[model samples]
Target: MRSTVSGYSALSKAHKFSAAGLVTVAGAAALTFALVPQAQAADVQSAGVKTVSLSAQEFGVTQDGELAKAADDAAGQAQVKAKAAVKAEVKAKADAADRERASRSEARKPMKPAAKPAAKPAPAKPAAKAAAAPVKKAYADNLDGWISESLDILRAKGIPASYDGIKRNIMRESTGNPQAINDWDVNAVNGVPSKGLLQIIDPTFKAYHVEGTSWNIYDPVANITASCNYAADKYGSMDNVNSAY
Candidate 1:
């Protein structure tokens, strides 16, 4: 009886240990199945989120490229505008300079000379009259006139002579004759006859002939004046003569 009891006890303990091990194994299999499905679902969700992040990054890159292109286009348009403005300014200045030069050229043009006026005709003068002849002084054609004319000539020639002395000498020499001749005298014998009113020889008459009188020895006034001039020279004056000098 003691050996059977001991064997029964051993068998009971071995069976209980096998049953517990089997229960532990079944629970581990159920937990492993449930955790495997959850891990698969988490992997699918993570893949979806990674695909969205990649799409967003690609969109951001495309937007940055478009913004850069816009900025470059704006800079190019500004450069073209600046160049056009500069060209317009240069053309305006050139046009203004050309206008100024044309204005100066017009101002410097020469003016035409004025026309001259015509001259007027001169007025007519009255006809001129013939000039009158000069009047001559007259004297009588006689011995008294001859003496008076000789006295006038002597007075003009600054020769000193008196009427009484000249008449006395004339009466003694030729008796107041203009055509008288002393043919029988010593002067006549020598071929130089004493002739005229004062009976003056040819050589003596020419030597003492007064200017503005006739050269003819028979001219009464010429003979008397020449004789008076000669007598005045030799005797200081014809008035001092008292004889046939």
Candidate 2:
């Protein structure tokens, strides 16, 4: 019976040792689970921090690039505007200079003379009229008219004589009788007879007959002109004769 009791005590001790080993293995497994979870959490937090920093750097780079591009564009636009302004100003100045030069050139030129008005044409003259016929002058029908007519003929023929001298000579020769004849005188002894107011012979009357007078020897105007012509030739004039010439 004692041997059976010892065997039972040994079996109890072995069961107690197995139970302690099991408890230790359980405690190690629980500790490993808690430490692995804490380590995984720390690694996740670090990866997140790195990811956030990289994202912030990329955003900054993009923003800087945009700002630089904007600045370059603004600068380019400013340059273009400035150049356009400068070109416009230069053109304006050139235009002003051209205008000023033209003004000065115009001022230096001489003033033009005023234009003269066109001359008016002269008026046409009227046509000349034809000459009219001369009117005959009327004289009295008397001895005075005959004497005046002879005197007018003598003046026309350029013969010079006086009315008083002719009348005095006519009164002495024929007593103012145009038809008287001196047939008994020295002129009558010849073939030609003296006749008319001045007693002129036919040959003497023909030789001294004035133009525009009657050819008849007894014609009063014809005889007077012919005798006066003969007297003017023989003597200085009929006015100097006081008797038969």
Best by lDDT: 1
Off by over 4 Å in 1: 1-134
TM-score of 1: 0.46
lDDT of 2 by residue, 15-101 (tens): 334434433543322122111233344453344334444555565677689999999999999999999999999999999999999
Highest TM-score model number: 2
Give me candidate 2's TM-score against the actual structure: 0.50
RMSD of 1: 22.9
User: What C-alpha lDDT values do all the predictions have?
Assistant: 0.77, 0.72
lDDT of candidate 1 over 69-116, digit per residue (tens): 999899999999999999999999999999999999999988767777
How does residue 223 of candidate 1 score in lDDT? Answer: 97
